[model samples]
Target: MFNNAINAYQTIQNEGLSDRETEARVLTQAARRLIICQREWAQPNLRERLGDALQYNQRIWTIFQTEMLEETNPLPLEIKRNILKLSQMVDRRTMDTLTEPEPEKLDLLIRINENVAAGLRGSVTGPVGQF
Candidate 1:
């Protein structure tokens, strides 16, 4: 999970996005990865790892949102809304998984992440809170 986050961060940086935007994008990616892990891996240990990843992603998102909002150049509303939506999805998935997931559920989650990266990238510019 850490490796995935690192890879995502590196990818964003390689694209020349600002540090703040890169971090936000990476966290979003990490959250998406966790969603994938939760759906694909059946092992209890793997599920626990996914939980950890979710927690970490939530922390990153919270920090990013707060910092971005405080910046003189605030993030656009569309990006902020997307971030909130992603966060809510994580929360919902985690809550649902506390029990047991239905069949084909993982596939749905995989699809969610598959499209989220592009949407996240398209939502904002000039870093996460720099309008």
Candidate 2:
């Protein structure tokens, strides 16, 4: 699934998607990796796999932070602030999970990734305030 997701992202990229679509694919890929790690937590290779997944997710959020912080970014100030706040939450949760290594700790990261990806794709179903 991980390889398939990467292939899908690459194919989407080659097909000339908008930036939001590319970002959505990236977030979905990250979320899928974390979901895999979470589901396989009891496997013998969990430590290494979890570390890689967490690092991958962290890198994705870090890229988002860098983009949002750029002075030329076009997002409204309120929206940028909200995204940064969410990224901060991701950062803290990531650090906590790295320190304590709990299976349940991955839920928030997964949810954030899924929600943000959905939002990027304009498929969010709930009220706007929920996001």
Candidate 3:
């Protein structure tokens, strides 16, 4: 699944979209999928897996954001700066959460999985326009 997402991200980049936009979309979708996967796999060890996945996804986003900021893309400089700031905020938050100790870490993962599942279910069953 990660590989497939990476391929899709690459396709988007190849099609002339700015790396920032392509990465934002890909990371958002990947994060959603990781949450869903954690909810589905709900095992005792799933918290560790979720933490790892979160770290990996954040790393991917950070790398993409860094590369995009360094590149001389045609995107407006201000927009690029904003994207970098947002990406840094996300990276910091994810890192802070993932670095929490044991039980706290587990609790965080469970809450995240539950929230994602709730949102996913709501989107699927609620009014068509709600999501």
Clash total of candidate 2: 0
Q: What would the per-residue lDDT of candidate 3 be over residues 36-96, giving only the tens digit for each residue? A: 5445565667666666666656656566586667766766888677657756765665667
Q: Give the per-residue lDDT digits (tens) of candidate 1, residues 77-107.
A: 7776776676567557655664574534444
Query: Highest lDDT: which candidate?
Result: 2
Pairs clashing within candidate 1: 75-129
Q: TM-score: which candidate is best?
A: 2
Q: Per-residue CA lDDT of candidate 2, range 12-102, in tens?
A: 7888998789878788777877888877888999988888888877877777888899999999999999999999999999999999999
Whichever of 1 and 2 has more TM-score, that candidate is 2
Residue 42 shift from truth in candidate 1, angstroms:
3.2
lDDT of 1 at 113: 43
Q: Give per-residue lDDT, candidate 1, residue 45.
A: 73
- Per-candidate Cα lDDT values, in order, are 0.56, 0.82, 0.55
Looking at candidate 2, the ten consecutive residues that score lowest on lDDT are 122-131
Per-model TM values vs. the true structure: 0.49, 0.84, 0.53
